[model samples]
Target: MTEEPLPTNASSGVVRVGDTVRRPAGPWTDSVDALLAHLHAVGFHAAPRPLGRDEQGRQVLQFLSGEAGSPDPRWSTTDLGAVGRLLREFHDAAADFTPPPDAVWQTAIPADREDLVVHHDPAPWNLVRRPAGWALIDWDAAGPGSRLWDLAYAAQTAVPLRADRPLAPTLPRLRAVVDGYGLDDAGRAALVPMLHRRVTAMVELLRSGAANGRRPWARIWTEDGPYWQRTADHLAAHTDDWAAALG
Candidate 1:
């Protein structure tokens, strides 16, 4: 089988072979596999099925057929809503999952709470759109996390709370996402703050990683560090505005 390399910003050595995606495996792979299996078992089929490993000792996953990125129109109101709904389904399903006794994960950033396992990196780059529906790929980052923590990151990327983009127009899209997730009043209030924390954490991660000479993080920090720092400041500045928008 021809191993075609998959383009990704963070990880390298990912390739598609026939109907499976083969990628580097680690101590965390078993735990991730268990999480995916549980998602499928609970009927949250938007994730790829874990196919064990390939002959090359790399982890194998079902190669979902679709374009990987933000949906057409790129963060249209409808797509944002779908992203929220899908994330909700995944979180709800994950709530009942039990990690293996020896489970290990690659959670770089700690969550406010470990209520359940979550797709820590549910950004637009990891989302895939197919004829059937949307699917989130790249489960390597799957691990213990809070619902809002995961959702905040998703909202940041999908709604794209950037410093440069005007906030007025973005408010409706943020509302669309929160509403689609069916977030309650409590969740809505908490989400505003979580957005600031999540983006700030990202900036800190990049900054520290670069200082510590971490692999991809160090590399990415060199390129996008300033942008994320500016976005974090913007999120902090607009806390009240975000709260109002969610309301």
Candidate 2:
């Protein structure tokens, strides 16, 4: 009966209520609900099932029993591989989904291509580790996107392409994810560039949000804008190195 707030930097007003999660709804809710429905219909169960809206008009979803935003130190190579495979499963399952006629999306950052709807933000923080398996939460960002576009962001956070960390060690983790996903040559070649673009887009989003005094984003920018900018610069400078590592 009591609403317990969920921890995440990507969105606000998300809380747990019994066996479901309730979050602020928007014009994009219908489209996201449809996307999740399709995924489950196709047998992709790594995501929370949409349960329509609550009395308060907030979107409700299955309250997955697991921990969110677990520390990276606890993540093993095997866990990273599972994350890759899970992402691949979600992408493949989503490929055949057709958006509703009047579909609206929360396209905070424009996608590289609108191949299909995807969990635009598939970072570790959104990933939940359950005893049975892992599940990705926060489907509010689900909408038009490409596999590489999604995967690039996943790798950026999961492999954690931070300016503070050494690039060499992270490369193997990146490779593990790619291998788990079974990426093709073209996908491999396109990954680094896409990663650079994704990170750059995030930096721009934070910068613009901060400039315009947007809620949450502005706050996030104030707290971590410099880190994102530095990460974007690091990714841009080492694009070739990242590509080579993937090869």
| Residue-wise C-alpha lDDT for candidate 1, range 1-247, written one tens digit per residue | 8999998888899999999999999999999999999999989899999999877799999999897785223568888899899999999999999999999999888888998999899999899988888899999988899999999999988888888888898899989888989999999999999998998888888899999999789998999999999989999999988999998
Q: What TM-score would candidate 1 get against the native?
A: 0.97
Q: State the local distance difference test value for candidate 2.
A: 0.88
The collision pairs in model 1 are none
Alpha-carbon deviation at 51 in model 2, angstroms: 1.3
Per-model TM-score on C-alpha atoms: 0.97, 0.95
Q: What C-alpha lDDT, on a 0 to 100 scale, does residue 78 get in candidate 2?
A: 82
Error of 2 at 100 (Å): 0.8
Best by lDDT: 1
As a TM-score, model 2 comes out at 0.95
